[model samples]
Target: MAAGAIPATKLAYFDNMWAVQATATLLSHLETEDGRRALILDSTIFHPQGGGQPADTGFISGAASGFKFVVEDARLKDGLVYHYGSFENPQDDCVSIAKEGEEVSLYINPQRRDLNSRLHSAGHLLDICIRKMGLSHLEPGKGYHFSDGPFVEYKGIIPPDLLQIKSKELEKEANALILAGGKVSAPVLSYNEAAECCGGVLPSYIPTDSAPRIVKLGEHPGCPCGGTHVADIADIRNLTADAPHTNGMP
Candidate 1:
C-alpha cells in the first residue's frame, strides 16, 4: 500500500455503484486511530480486480492531500485496498487521516472503468447463454477480453454444426432476455439451495456451507456471480459473437 489512498469499506464484490461527480471531504483512519488521513474523494468508478476480473484505473486529487494523486494499482483483500499514494508531508494535516464524515472529491477514469465493467458483464451473459444451449459439459477456460472485445475458450468438444446453431441461438436468447427488461438480482443462498440451482453440486472451488450469491437474469438465467453487472439486461447492446468452434480444445 502507498500513501494518501482512502480504503472503501462499504463495497463488496459485484457492486456497480459509481459517482458521476467528484467530492472532497474527511474520513476517519482505520489503520491508525491517532492519525487522520484527508478524505480526498466521495465516490469512485475504479473497479478492483477479483473473480477473474481486472482492476480499474483512475486518479484522485485535492488540496488536503496534494495537487494530484494517481491510482497506480487497485486490488481486493477480504475486500479493501489502502488507495496507495504520496503526500507533501508525512505528518501534514492534508495527509493526516481523518475520521468518517470527512469530505473528499473522487475522480475516476470513467472511460476505462466503463469498458472493463461492460466486458465483465458480457462475460457473465456469455456463460449463461452457453449453459442454456444444453452444453452443460463445457466449462470456461481462459476468458480474456478488454474494452475492445472479449474471447472465451470452452473446455469440451463441440460439434461444428451444433456449435454454429448453438451460438446463434444463444445470441438470440441473450438479446431477447436483455430486451425483455428483466431485473437482475444478487441474493445469498444456503448451500443446499445453491447446489440445487447448480444441478446438484457446487463447483469444487466454491466454499461449502457458506451462502452463495446468485445472479438472477429474469426468470430464465440464474447462476453464481461475484462481478459487477448492470441493473437490467437492456443496458447491454450491440452484442454479437464469432462462431463457436472446437479448435481451442486440446
Candidate 2:
C-alpha cells in the first residue's frame, strides 16, 4: 500500500510477445479501495491497458495452494502492474489466497492476446503506409486499436480533395505490405541508436539518457514503442483504413 513498498515489475512481454505462459514470484496480494482484488508480481507477462491497447485478461494460479485468480483486467500505475480480479475461491474468512514470495504461473488468453497484437501491429503498419504514400505531413497522433473499431489519428489535416483517395491508397498499401510479409522486431537500444533507427529523431517525451525499445517492421524505419506486437507483419493477415478525420485541428 505504501508508495515504495514494491519495485517496478519486470515486463516479460517486452522481450517475447508470443509467450502466453510464464512464471513469476508473487509480491503482494491486496484488496483495492474499491474492494477488488489485485495481485502484484515481480515479473509479469500480462500487458496492461494503455497506449490505446486494451488490457489482457487471464488467470494466475498459485503453485502451492492451487488457488486460482481470474484476471479481469490489468493496469500499470507508477511503474507497478496491478492484476485486478477475484480469486476463483476466496477463503470464507476473506484471507488472500496468494501469499508473498510464492511462485505463480500466469496464463494469458491466447486468442485475446493474438487479436490484440495483430490490431496493434496493424496500426504501426498503417503509419508506415502513410509515410510511404507521401502523406508524411500528417503527423501520427493517438491510436485506438480496440477490436470494435481500430483507427489511428493524425495531428495534421488533409485536403478535402485528397481525403477519399488517400484512405483508399493507405488501405491498399497496407494489405500489400502484409501480403509481402516481413519480420517484426522490437529491441532496446541506447538513446542515440534509437534516434538513428527512428530517422535521426526520437520523440521529445523519451528521456535523453534512457535506452528505448524501438519496433521495426522489416526495412521500414523504426519507432519507439512500449507495447507488444506480432512476430511478423504478415501475421496481421489483412487490414483496412478509413478516411482520416479531425476532432478540432484547424
Candidate 3:
C-alpha cells in the first residue's frame, strides 16, 4: 500500500508507537483506468488535529512502484483518518492496487514531531506547576497554545500577590528541576499507588484498570500523563507566565 495513507483504525501515540512502524493495511484503492493516479493505505500515524492538538505532517513511499508522496493534510471522517497526497501518472494499463494485507512505511517529520512533543509536555508541566503553588481553585482556560511558545490562561482572575509569587515560584522550580537533570519517568502504577502518589483520587477521565503513566520531576513534582516528554528536565529551556488577574479561578 502507499505510505502515509489513512488506516481502518487510529493508532495512538501515547507510548511512542509511531517510532516503530508507520504501515497500514490496504483497505480500498482508487485510480484512473490508465493507471494515472491512485490512493491506498490502511493505517497511519499522521495525527489529524483533535483534542486541541495540531495535525501531524509526514511522507509516504511505495518501494515496488517507486511511489513517494508528501502528506499535505490529515483529517477525520466518520471516525476514519484520511491522508491526502499526490503522485505522478503511471504507465500501466490498469491501476493495480496494493494487496489488502500489504504494509507500507510512513516517515513522519522529526522536527514537527519534536515540536509537538515539547508543546504537549510543556502544557502538562504548566498544569502541575500551577497546582503546586497551592492555587487549588485555578483551572486552565480554553485556547491553550502548545506550539512555538507555550502558555495557558486561567479561568478567572488571579490575585496579584498569588500570581506574582506563583510566576516566580513555578519558573524557578521548573528551571531548577531542569538544571538538576531530573528524569521524566513513566512507571505504570496500580490504582492504589496512583491515588496515593497523586494526593487522592485519579481524575474522572483516567481509566480505572489501565496502568497510569506518571511524569515526575525529581522529588518535587509528579503527575499522570500520556504525552511524550524530554528524557530529562534539563531539556526544557525556559518557562514564564503573563496576564495574571484577581477575578475568578482558572
Candidate 4:
C-alpha cells in the first residue's frame, strides 16, 4: 500500500516455471532517482534477476484503465521483487500515476525466458557430462550461462591435451540426455531428503535442518538451485560446447 513497505511477493514462477502470464495486484509503486520507476506486485510470475540468470523482461497493463507499463527488468531487494519499468497512460494526463491496489496483468517475454532456461539447464547438464568423461573429482565451481557464451567452470582445469576431445565428448553426452527428454523436477525437501535426492550430497551453505529446493534433471544428479529451468530436458535440444576452460589448477 506504500513505497518501501515490504509485501510478500508470491513468485508463481516457483510454483510453476512454465507460466508466462499472470494477473497481479499492485501492492505498491516507487519512483527512484531521476524519475525511474518500479511497481511491486502481490504475486508475480516473473523471475527477478539473480542466481546467474538474467531478469525477466515484460510488460504490465492495468486491468481496467488499460494503462501500460513497459517492464525492462525485475529485481529483488530484501524479500520483495520489484518490476522495474516505465509507466505511461497514453490517453490521460496523470503525471507519475499508477494507482496503488490496482489490478494488472503481467506478460513475461517467452523467448527470453525459454532461451535463458535452456542455457542455464545446459550449464548444469554440462557438469554431468564432464563427470561422465571420467573426471569424477571435479567439483562445480562457477558458471556463465548467459545466452551470449555459456560455460561452467570446475574446481580444477582439464589437461590442455584433452580439452578439445573432452569438450566434444561432453557435448555429445549432454545432447544425448537432452534428446532423451527426461523430466526436470524441482521439489522442496528437508535437508536429508534433499541430500538423498541429490546423491547424498549437500552444499556447504545449505543448513542440514532446513528444507532445500532441489532440481533433478532426469536420472543425473540433482542440485540445489533457485534459477528457472525447463520442465523437460527435451526442451533443450542443442547444448553445445566450446571447450572446457578453468582457473589455474588448485
Candidate 4 lDDT by residue in tens digits, 103-213: 889999999999989988888888777777788778787777687777777776577888788878888888888888899988888898999988888989998789888
Best by TM-score: 2
**TM-score of model 4 vs. true structure:** 0.91
Model 1, range 1-250, lDDT digits (tens) per residue?
A: 3224545544433344344345544343233343422222233445566666666555555555344445555555433443444443445454344334545555666666556656666677778777777777998877765655577777887776676777778788777766776666666789788777666777787788698877666554456766566666676664677777676532
Against the hidden reference, what TM-scores do the models get? Answer: 0.68, 0.95, 0.69, 0.91
In the range 1-250, model 3's lDDT, one tens digit per residue, is 4333544545445445236246655454554345433334556667666544566667666665455556665556555565655543443532353344556567778777666655655666677666766765776664344575456666755666667666778787666555666656656688778776677777777788877866665554456764455655566666666535455533
Candidates in order have lDDT scores of: 0.59, 0.89, 0.59, 0.81
Better of 2 and 3 by lDDT: 2
Supply candidate 2's per-residue lDDT for 63. 74
| Off by more than 4 A, model 4 | 33-35, 89-96, 246-250
Tens digits of per-residue lDDT for model 2 on 1-250? 3436999999999889889999999888888888888899999999999988999999999878668899999999999999999888577633354678889999999999999999999999998998998889988889998999998888787887777788889899999999999999999999999999999999899999899999999899999887889999999999877777656422
Clashes of 3: 11
The deviation in Å at residue 102 for candidate 3 is 2.7
Model 4: per-residue Cα lDDT at residue 6:
64
> Lowest lDDT 10-mer window, candidate 1?
32-41
For residue 163, give model 4's deviation from the true position in Å: 0.9
Ranking by TM-score: 2, 4, 3, 1
Angstrom error at residue 206, model 2: 1.0
RMSD of 1: 6.1
